[model samples]
Target: MTSEIQSYNFNGASLRTLTDGAGEPWFVAKDACDILGMSNPSMAVTALDKDEVAQIDPKDYLGSENRSNQAVNIVSEPGLYKLIMRSRKPEAKEFQRWVTHEVLPQIRKTGGYIPTSESDSDEDIMARAVL
Candidate 1:
């Protein structure tokens, strides 16, 4: 019904992750950029291939204060992998391995994503984002 965020730690990076009801994974673009050693995610996403952008979208997330955090462009599974593939970080391969061999498969098996509380429900978050 709404977007969700699941903060996952990889090595030392804190990745803001997401999964829809269909178990498709997405990541907060800025967080992804930060993890991959980029300075500007907004500019970076613009440089992505058009086909890549087609699968991604920009959405606002509700932060701990229960208010709309800055809008973070969200990337879909393909975009996540593409960003990883384009990265030269030593952990790129390791990140891919974890997400593919572990996180993704686990989500697929589970079938849905659940956020922490009613404050994070899609409608609630979307409402805050709109405000």
Candidate 2:
């Protein structure tokens, strides 16, 4: 399937721009998916509910697919962020193990790291560190 990049808002929150201090962009949905061990939107939602990932709101998009009109807002939780940081294109099984074994435990130990209300998924996490 040809993936389309769309702007997503997380619960009506503000969106963040993805940029590195070095002027580089970070984190794409396809890459994020592989990193988070999520094969679909449902899995992403589940991960968010479990507090295994950081949430983000996609306010605008660059690619053709327009999900801006969808009913549910999309988010990228911390677990997925961790995975994405480790591997921009991680294998499915590898992503799963990292999320279940490493990422989840970290979040639990930290008592959960909630994404800032101003966080945005359309941008790179490292670039939007201030959020």
- Candidate achieving the largest lDDT: 1
Worst 10 residues of 1 by lDDT: 54-63
Off by over 4 Å in 1: 1-3, 21-23, 49-60, 65-69, 91-93, 96-131
| lDDT score at residue 124, model 2, on the 0-100 scale | 56
**What stretches of model 2 exceed 4 Å from their correct place?**
1-31, 34-37, 49-59, 63-68, 71-77, 81-90, 93-131
Evaluated against the true structure, the overall lDDT of model 2 is 0.43
Give each model's whole-structure lDDT: 0.65, 0.43
lDDT digits (tens) for residues 28-122 of candidate 1: 77778887776778887886766454333333343452344345576776877788778777756677677677766756986433322444778
How well is each residue in 1-131 modelled by candidate 2, as lDDT tens digits? 11233233333422322433443333344445534444664454453444343223333443333356533233334544544444434454555565566646866986443343445554554444444
Q: Candidate 2, which ten residues in sequence have the lowest lDDT sum?
A: 1-10
Tally clashing residue pairs in candidate 2: 12
